[model samples]
Target: MAIEPLAIGVCSWSLQVKNVAELKVFLDRLGIDVVQIACGDPHHAAWDEGDAMPAAARAAGFRMSGAMLGFPGEDYTTPQTIERTGGFGDPATRAERTERFKWALSRTKELGLADLMLHAGFIPAVGAPERKAFLDTLAQVSDLALRAGVTVAFETGQESSTLLRRTLDDLKCPNLKINFDPANMLLYDNDDPIQAIELLAPDIRSVHVKDANRPSTKGVWGEEVPLGRGQTDTRRFIQTLKKAGYRGPLCIEREAGTQSERFHDIEYGVHFLRECLAG
Candidate 1:
């Protein structure tokens, strides 16, 4: 079978829209029909229609590349705050987060998607006391995804690619893969995005086309900028993805601006990616 060319899409939450209707309007304006939709979870991007969102999204006509899920208490206010709350990182929240993951898996199936993307949180170092529990939680979620026939893509950046690669190796779950975001590597002041992609190439199931500059201080968050405007070197990022054999959709995610600014930036990103892909 022939491989489909990569499609350029946007994250639904990036548009900051409230419902499927609003999302459609923006998608039309952006001139793109592809999206990686939020699951309408209270924390990430809640829909005005609530429970009716799945059916509405399924009927919305846009091509959904995947679904995104964010936990309720995830705090992006600071690096430390998220380290304490993001993903399945907190041992205290593992049970509840696992249940949330179950719900997200169901939503992925309902939306006719095979991939669900989320941050697995900051990983515990290999020899740390919490390492075993963290890996076990990841395995539990991965097993759930396996049974559901959905691929769970943990977004990169919370930890170094080496640690993530090690964790994946330990779990050995075929359904668990990566949703590579080059900008995140810089934002979290983790690994070099270019090198990280090379290391995690085989497991990259999706890509987020974003850009950012490293933080000035060690513990501070980096600055997120429009595509091709920061340190991500987006043109080279696309080239690297191509060289790494990644053929998934490139979903533009701009979370740093007002809704109007975000829309404009994403629109610009569409053109930026098209130019890079063509080159």
Candidate 2:
């Protein structure tokens, strides 16, 4: 099969800019036009004002690939902390999160976005009551997204691909999909990214082109390195993505490093990914 060229994009927040103008300056310098817009953080002042994500991306002359939402209180400081405080899996926060997701659905439509992405938290093991509840929460989110005529691509990494596949199958929601992050699998010790791309190919609607190492200690957070600098084999990773027929933006995400440091890494990463794609 002929390999499709993936759009070189980046998660807007990864640039850590103060505004869209700053982001545009950096994106222009980096030669990137696609952006996964950031939205739905109740804590974010710009998001709280609404319509900021799409407007900003448009003003910046970016192709808004999609929007990513984060719950108000997710603590990603450590694996254990996230298991307790991340995603919509927790019943204590599910109701509130559902409302937030519903708002996001409306905002997505208003912004004319095709879809949005979010972390659904750690899906409990099959047959666990926690699993059932988590599924229900996601189901509700799916309903809202579908009704709004958009997809919700759940981010990978907190759970195994097998379990994620099973959960999606169990729900049988058409609007739900995957934002495959290869680095996350290695970081979270969930599954190998190449293996996951094969397993979840049909459902992957977007991709994160970040790279990372496995956690130093199980249950601890892993170190996120610059692209091609970590264990995420870029050669096999992109090859598998092309072979699997995924046609989506390879959204670069750099969650670590200083502003200048991150910008420099992203610049190098864009070149590295393009070189890999060329071959």
Candidate 3:
């Protein structure tokens, strides 16, 4: 079968603006067609206001693919947690992660979304024991997701592609997929953004279109750049995704900047990606 090119979209925190109508109007002006909502506790949640979500998207004539579900143990600074345990092998940590996973699962359903993405906890491959533990946790989470009837994805980073592939192989769950964020791999200094396409292509369900500096800084996070202007080869990346048969949304995430800057960057990114897909 022939592969299809990706559809473009934007992941916005702009909905947090006091004037959501204005924001939607702005997005429409930029021609953004999709928005990935950020899910979390009601107070800090991205689209907590009951009427904010559908109203804004409706006004703009945009579709919402899903929300980025916030999971517990997200705080890596904590002393003892799934994140500290390296994402899913410790029994106690897995229990905690399970609770967080359940919360995300329930929240996504409540939002009437069929798909969501999250950090599957990072298990650094420091040794044999750590590797085994990480695999165990991956299996457990995959099982949890199977019961939820929703697609759950692990945002790339925190591990090498080989290790991630191995982890997925061990679990063998159909629902578990990759939310391929090229900048993440580059930011972590783990792999080249373009190379990751070959390693993770088959498992990708969604993508985060952004850019970053090269991984020459050694343990430091890469700087986030606007689309088509960073270490990620946005054009080739999209072409590779198409070759891999990934047809999911290309969600543009702009993590920095003021409302004006963010809106501009995201709009620029959406257009950049649209051109990439077309080419």
Candidate 4:
């Protein structure tokens, strides 16, 4: 089978749009038809049409690369808060979150997409008391995805590539892959995104084309900037992706700015990626 050439696109939620109509408007403005859409979970990006979002998106005349799900009650105010509340990390929230994942899998099928992306939260260190439970929750979710015929791509950066890689090896779930986000490694102060690509390349199913600078203060969030404006080295990032054989859509995600600002930055990101890919 021939691999598809890499295409540049954007995350639907990054536009901060409230409905499929609004998303279409922005997609047209950006002149791109490919997107990784939100699953209309209240915590992520809820749509005005509510349960009808899937139908609306189907008729919206764009290509959906995948669907994204953010569990309810996830707080991103600080690294600490997110570590505690993100994904299947906390044993207390496993049952509820697993149900949410099931719903997302159905929604993904409705969207006619095979990939679902999400943050798996901060992974517990090897041999930690809570580690077993965390891995067990992930395995359950992976099993659900396999049955749904959907590939779940966990977003990177909640932990080191080493740990994430080990977790994947431990689970050995074929459907459980990775959604590579370069800026995330910087934001979380976890690892060098470039080096991480080499380690996690084989399992990379999608890519997020954003840029960021490492946090000056430990335990704080990094600074997200327009593409090509941060320490991510946009040019090298693209080059590395190609070398690593990741030929997926580059979805621009801007989570640190206002609605208007995010739009502007994403627009810039599209052009920036064009140059990188072209070069």
Candidate 5:
């Protein structure tokens, strides 16, 4: 079997540098050919301004890869967190989140980015009205995303694979997709990342090439380890992606460590993914 060359990108959040020019230099030094800019500055709103991505992107020979939509909202796992973030339980707060998501959708289009990776609210507990509200709001936001011609993908973390699959099914929008993050499942103890990939293969639109150590001690989230150093079997994961016909960019993200460490992880992950795809 032969694997065609695929673009390898790292999430800019890992670089921990706010300036796009500095980020380009850092990624260039790490030999990263592509990058996913995850700008979280509320004031910049680069996605909305169409100026968040500096001109250096072209000069540096890197692509705008994608945008990881980050906003202050419910973390997608616990309903209480949703309430804390002014979602689900609060009607007034829910409206605010909706407007924010709309801004993100518009921002994504303004930036000429193709996808907006985010957490689609939370999965409420059984018999909870919050669950209904979350689904209802999701449908509305999804409609906006569809009209914008940009994909709004839910990151795979905080919820079970089944929950995410069901939510995606219910959204019923062509632009709705999944940004599978294997390490998140490990960190949250949601499910086996590999198995999740198998079951949700058809909807996997993007992959986060980060790794994690499964929880060994009690009450601890899985540790974020360097690519191939954690419990994630990235080679098998890539094989699964190939088998499932996922042709999207493998966006590498390092959620922990210093600037130098994150760059190292990106380097390791990009090379490992390429070799795995080739094999």
Candidate 6:
């Protein structure tokens, strides 16, 4: 049997770089060409106004496996806070966020990319009136992506895989998918990310390579540790994805630690994942 070659990458935001040129320097040292970028950061000049950043990143030999969108007022301090003010959840901010989502979709299309990931806030329970509104909001943005020929991938772990899967099934939107993040599972204290793979495999468009420990107490945030140093079983996780027939980039995402430390972790992650893939 022929083993699949590893396609490791890093999220641009994880590197804390200002632009694609800086990102290229690090990616070259890491020996990779793919990156998952937060497409429209207001502070980042490259993504300030137009398609310039994506174009330049490509010229510098980087291929975007995915793009990310983040809404203003997303508070991760507490679950309640985020539920009250995260993603497109708040009615007061829905209109503005909706417009942002549309614009982000346009950029995703212009970058010639397919997978766009974002937080959709905590999903309400099935049959809840609020669920309808959430689905309706998602449909509107998904329609824009469909027209733009882009796949809108929701990053996993904010909600249970079951809820997300049910939502996608009900929506039945072809352009909707999932970017599985196992660390998020532990961070959110949701279902096991390994089992999540079994459940959400069909919809997994991409995956994030990170690690975190489960929250020790309810209503508290979990701790994020370096890749393979937390709760995730790195080897088994990659095996699960491979078993599920997912053959996409496993992007490194280190949102904690100092800049140099984070870079070291991501560099180690690339080699670690490569070993897992080979094993």
Superior by TM-score: candidate 3 or candidate 5: 5
lDDT of 1: 0.91
Q: Evaluate model 2: give its TM-score.
A: 0.94
- Pull out the clashing pairs in model 6: none
- Reference-based lDDT, each prediction: 0.91, 0.83, 0.69, 0.91, 0.70, 0.82
The parts of candidate 3 lying over 4 Å away from their true place are 1-5, 14-26, 41-45, 50-61, 72-93
lDDT of 3 by residue, 19-53 (tens): 44655676677776566666643322444344455
Query: Is candidate 2 or 3 superior in TM-score?
Result: 2
In Å, residue 157's CA in model 6 sits off its true spot by 0.8
lDDT of 1 at 242: 94
38 Cα displacement, candidate 1 (Å): 0.3
Q: Write the per-residue lDDT of candidate 2 for residues 1-279, one digit (tens) a residue.
A: 121359888887787776667778888999978877777464332543345655655555667788888888888788888888888867888888888888777777666687799898999999886677678788888888877889999999999999999999999999999999988898888888888787799999999999999987887778899998899998789988999998888889998888889899999999999998988
Q: In model 2, what are the clashing residue pairs, if there are any?
A: none
Q: Judge candidate 3 at residue 219 and give its lDDT.
A: 52
- The predicted structure with the larger TM-score, 4 or 5, is 4
Leading candidate by lDDT: 1
Tens-place lDDT per residue, model 4, 1-279, is: 122468888898889899999999999999888898999987678999988989999998988899999999999999999988999888899899999999999999988889999999888999999888888888988899999899999999999999999999999999999999999999999999999999999999999888999999999999988999999998999999999998898899998789999998898888888888889
- Candidate no. 1 TM-score: 0.97
**Which pairs clash in the backbone of model 4?**
none
